[model samples]
Target: QPVTEEPSALAPPAAKPKSAVFYRHLRLDFPAIVRGEGSYLILDDGRRILDASGGAAVACIGHSDARVGEAIMSQIKSASYCATLLYTSTVCEQLCRLLVDSTNGQMARAYIVCSGSEAMEASLKLARQYFLEKTQPEPQRTHFIARHQSYHGNTLGALAVGGHKSRRLPYEPILSTNVSHVSPCYAYRGKKAGESDAEYVVRLADELDAEFQRVGPEKVCAFVAEPVVGGALGAVPSVPGYFKAIQAVCRKYGALFICDEVMCGMGRTGSLHAWQQEEGVFPDIQTYGKCLGGGYQPIAGILASHEIIDTISKGSGAFVTGHTYQGHPVSCAAALAVQHIVAEENLLANVSELGPYLGELLTKRLGDHPYVGDIRGRGFFWGIELVEDKATARPFPPKANVAMEIIDLGLKGADYSVALYPGSGTADGVSGDHVILAPMFNASRAEIETIAD
Candidate 1:
C-alpha cells in the first residue's frame, strides 16, 4: 500500500535557508562567486579579483571556457549517468587512452576517479592489492611510508597517509595505524650546512633505508610522496637526484614507489608529468588531478605501471574497488575538452617559457623585501616564504596567521588586487607562513608581470 499526503492548507511557511550551503569556514562571511573569466573571479558585489593562484592551482586553463562547457553539455544531452560496473562509455575510453598515450606508454593503465583524493586513495589501495596479487603474495605487507609535513587528501584513507599535523590533529586517534612518515627532502630547512646536493641525496636515501629497516621492510607496501611539495610545504622542490635516490631505496626494500602529483602534475610543472622532467625518477603508480580537469567537472585519475596491472590482472582478475561515479561520462568529456585545449594551444610551451620569467620577476619584485625569506619553485608553481627575521629565516608564529592576512590583503587591499594561495605550518609542521603564486599556464607576459607587481 502507498500512502500519499497532501499539503495542509494551514501548513506554516518554510523557514528560511539560514544561509544554506555549509562553507569551509563557519564564522567567516564568504563571497558569492557569480562568474569567472580568464584568470579572474567575479563576485556578486561586482568586484573582479585576479586569480593568481588558480584557486589552489586548479584552473590551469583559467575559467569560463565555452569549449569545455559545450563538451559537457553534449555528453549530458546523451546520458549523464551509467552504472560502470556493468558498462562503459566512449568518452571514458577516450579519456583513458589519451592519458595513457600522454605518458608515452610509461604508464600502461588509467583509473579515472572524481578527485585527487580519490585518485590517491586508489593508488594506496592498488599498491597494497598489488602486493597481495603478486606471485610472492605479500599478505604481510600492510604498512606505508610517507613524508612528514605533507598533505595527500582529506578522506580517512588519504588523511591517514598524509603527515600534515594540523589537519590530522582531530583525527589522529582514528587514523590508520599502518602508515609511518619519514623526513621530506627539503633543502631550505632539512639540509645540513656544508652538505652538497649529491651528499644530501645520499643522506636522505639512507634515512629512507633506515625507516624501511625499522618498519621491517617485508611489512611495507610502498613509499608515497609528492614530486614537488605542494601547499603543505609551499612549492618546495627537491634537489637533483633526490627522487632517484629515494626510488632506489624503495626498490632495494621491495617496496613500490607512489608519487602524488595531484597538485603538481598534468603540465602544471611545465612538463606533462613532473617525473618526466626528472632525469631518472619514475613511479610505479601516480595520481593526478586539479589541473587534470582544470576545475571544470571535478575529475582525477591514477596511472599504473605495466607490472603492477599485470600482477592484478593475473591474480584477482579484477580491481577490488568500485565507485558509482568512477568514470562519469560528463566529467570525462569536460576533462577531454580541457586537455584538448591544453594541447591545441600548446600551453606547455607557454608554461615553459613564462615559468622562468615569472620566477625572475618575483625575485626582482619581492627578493629584497624585508619580510621575504625564501623563494623557491619550478615551472608555473612558485612560493614566497614570509619571515619575521629574514637573516635568520625565522617564520612568524602560527597565531599571527601571516599567510592568511597576506591573502586577504591581496584580495581586498587597495594596492594589490589579486588572490594568492595562503599556506601555513610550513615550518616544523606547526609554525610557518608562505604564499604560493601559480598563475594560469597560458598567462600572458603582462599578466605574469601583474602577478609579480
Candidate 2:
C-alpha cells in the first residue's frame, strides 16, 4: 500500500481579524472580509458567511454589482464631488427624477442628503421652512412627536427625534429639547389585551393625538415614524389602518406627517415606499435610505410633495439647508444605477416574493421554540422576539445576552454565517429584545433558506 503523505503543519491557522477599537464590550475577533459576492461575505480565512443583516440592512441589491460599479467609475471620471450650491449634476438630478417617477409622479422633488440622519434633519428643517414659506410662521410649530422604540439615526438631531432609549440614553444631556415620543404601533407587545386590532390602532392614534395636544398642536411641526419600526424594536410594522389614523390626526392638527422610511423604504417593505401600500395616507415629508442606493453608495434623501415644494420654492425660493456631500457626483451615479437595476431587474417583486417565504420559515423554525415569542415583519424585513417564557412573555434579563448568543451561534454554525442584531428594551421602553433579518433584495430562495437556517 502506498504510504499516505503526512500532512504538513507548516502553516499555522491565520488569525481572525479584530475590531479596530473595543471600549467595554466583548473583545471581538471579527473575520477579515476580503470580498462580497451577491449575498455573501468572503472572509480572509476562506469562509463564506451569508450576510443576513447587511451591516444594518444596507446591502439591498447585494455586493459587487457591475452596473453600480461602472456607474461609480463613470462619475469618478467626470467629477467625484461638486458643490451643491454652485452646481447640480445630472446624476443627482436623474436619481431624484427616478425616485419621483417611481412614486407615480406624486412627489414634487427629492432633497439629496448624505445619510438618513441628514435627511431627517432636512425633513425637520424643511417642515419649518414650509410653514415660513406659507406665511404660517407659528413659532410654536417646533415640537416633533415621534414613535417610541424607533430609530432615526445616530446624529444629534435624529437621535433626539428618535424614541430608542438605548441609542438616546448616553446623549440625552445634549440632545434636542423640541421632541417628544409616543407609543409605537407595535401590536405584538403594545396592543391591548382584549382590544381588536382596529380598536388598538384607534387608541394608539388617540394617544399620539393626546401627546400632540399636550405639546400644543400648533407648536408641533411634524409627527415622525418608521412605517415599519426598525432595529430599535425589530421589524415591527403598524397594524392596518394605523397609518391612516395617524395621517388623519396629523391633518386634523395641520402638522406635517413626516414618514421616516429610512429602514423600511425603497422596496424593503415590498413596495417602492412603505406608505404606498397604506391606504389613504401619503406623507407630506418622507425620508429614505439604505436600499435607496441598494447599498451601492452612501445615499439618502427627503421627498417633498408638490405642496411642500411649492410652498418652499415660491415663498423662500430656497430650502434652508446645505451639505458639501449632499449630492456627490459619484454617489448619485451609483445610486442612480442601483435604482435603475432595482426597477429594470424587478427586484421589488423579488422582495415581495421572498419576504413572505422568509417570514414563514422563521415562524416554522423559531415560533414554537421556547425562546421565541413573536415573528413579525413585512417584505424581506422580519424580526424574531426572544422570551424566557412564552406564557409570561418575560424577556431574558439584559445580562443574559440572549440575542448576542444567537448571533454567535450563527457564526459558529457552519450551516450559515448570518448576523443577528440585538435590540434591548424593545417592550414598553425598558425591556424586551429581538433579532432582525433583512436579507438582500435579490436573494434567491436557496440563499433565503441558508439565511433563515
Candidate 3:
C-alpha cells in the first residue's frame, strides 16, 4: 500500500500567522508599535506617529518615562501583589492620600481599581450603598438619572447609566430600566437660535428636574454626568452655571451627584479636577481614570465625599465591593510616580499656559474649513467637529465615517503622522463626527503647534 500523506503535510503555509489577540475591529489590520519615545509611537515599519490624542487621553506625561519604569521595578522588587481585602500597600495608601489631598479634603476617601469602567461600576454601587447606609435609609432610591449623549463606561451598570445611543443599542435589552436620560448641556445645538447661556442652563436644569419627578425623586439614588463631556459628545463642556443648576436639581431631589471625570480629570483640563473649573459643582462621588496612571499602569479610582464615607463608616464600615487587583501595588506605584512628575514639573500650569494658544492655532487653521462646524475644548483636550453643511451644522451621515477616515489617514502618514481620537454621533446618536486632540500634559509649545498643524 502506498504511504498516505496527512492533509496538514500537503497544505501550504499561511501568508501570515493568525493573531491570538482579539482586536476591537476584526477586519482592520493594526500597525505593530515597536516602542514609544516621548510623544511619538515608533511603528515596526520605522514610522514615527505622534501620539496627539495620548491614546484616548490617557498618556498625560507621554510614553517611555524612565521615572515610571523605575517606580514599577522598585514596586515589583518590594511587593508586586497584595490582597487588598486582607492588606493595603504603602504605595496604595500614598496614592490615595495624594488624590484626596488634591481635592483639598473635599474628597474624603479613595477606592482604587484597574480601569475607568471598574471605577464607574464602583461609583454606581457606592451611590446605591450610600442611600442604604443613610441615617434614614432610602431603600427605594434605586434609580439613576444621566444625560443623553454622555458616556461613563461600558460595564452593565455604567452602560445603563450612560445615554450614548449607539453604545447602548446592542445591550439595551439587558440594561437596567431604573436609569433614564435627559438632554445634555450641549450649547452648540441644544442652545436655541437666540437663547442666552443662563436660559439654556435653566432649560436643561428644568428638564433634569422634570426627569427626576417622572422617575420619582425619592426613588432616584444619584444623577451622573461628566464635568466636561468626553468621547460620546466629543469634549463638550457645559455652559456657565450649567453644572450649578443641574447639581441644584440633584440636591433638591435628595440624590447624590456623581461626576465621571475619567477622561477630563487628572490635569487634562488644566485643573486637578474638572469640577474645579465649574463653580459650586462639587460632586458627592467622582470617578477618575485615563491620566490617573498616565498609561504607566492600569489604574482608576473613585473619590467619595465625606458625607458618603461617613454614612458608610457609621453603617457597615466597609464598601461592599472588591476586585482581585483592586489596589495592586505595582499599579499604584506607577501612578504615584506619574502624579509626582506632574506636580514637580508643574504640568497643570503648562496645560493652562499653552491651552489657549493651541485652541487659537486650531481655530485659525480649521475655523474656515467648510466641514469644520465647531471647535471647542479646554486645556490640552480639544475637539474639531466636522459637518456636511456648515450653515446648518448638519453632520455627515454615520456611514461616511468622516472622523475615522481622517484619523486613519493621519495614522497612515498620508498627510500627517499623528494619532487622533475619533467621535461619532455628535449631531444625534448616530450621525455626527468629531476628532479629539488631547496632547500630553508635558507637551511643549512646539508640540502643540505640530498637533494643531
State the TM-score for model 3. 0.95
Candidate 3 residue-wise lDDT, 107-207, digit = tens:
99999999999999999999989888783633789999998878999898899999887789998999999999998888777899999999999899999
Which runs of model 2 end up more than 4 angstroms from their true locations?
A: 1-26, 136-138, 426-431
Which residue segments of model 3 deviate by more than 4 Å?
Answer: 1-16, 135-138, 426-431
TM per prediction:
0.94, 0.93, 0.95
What is the alpha-carbon lDDT of model 3 when measured against the actual structure? 0.88
Show pairs that collide, candidate 1. none
Residue 65 accuracy (lDDT) in model 3: 95
Comparison by lDDT, 1 against 3, better one: 3
Q: What is the C-alpha RMSD of each candidate to the true structure, in Å?
A: 7.7, 4.0, 7.2
lDDT string, candidate 1, 287-324, tens digits: 99999899998899899999998988888889888788
Judged by TM-score, which candidate is best? 3
Residue 76 deviation, candidate 3, in Å? 0.3
Error of 3 at 96 (Å): 0.4
TM-score order of candidates, best first? 3, 1, 2
Model 1 reaches what TM-score against the true structure? 0.94
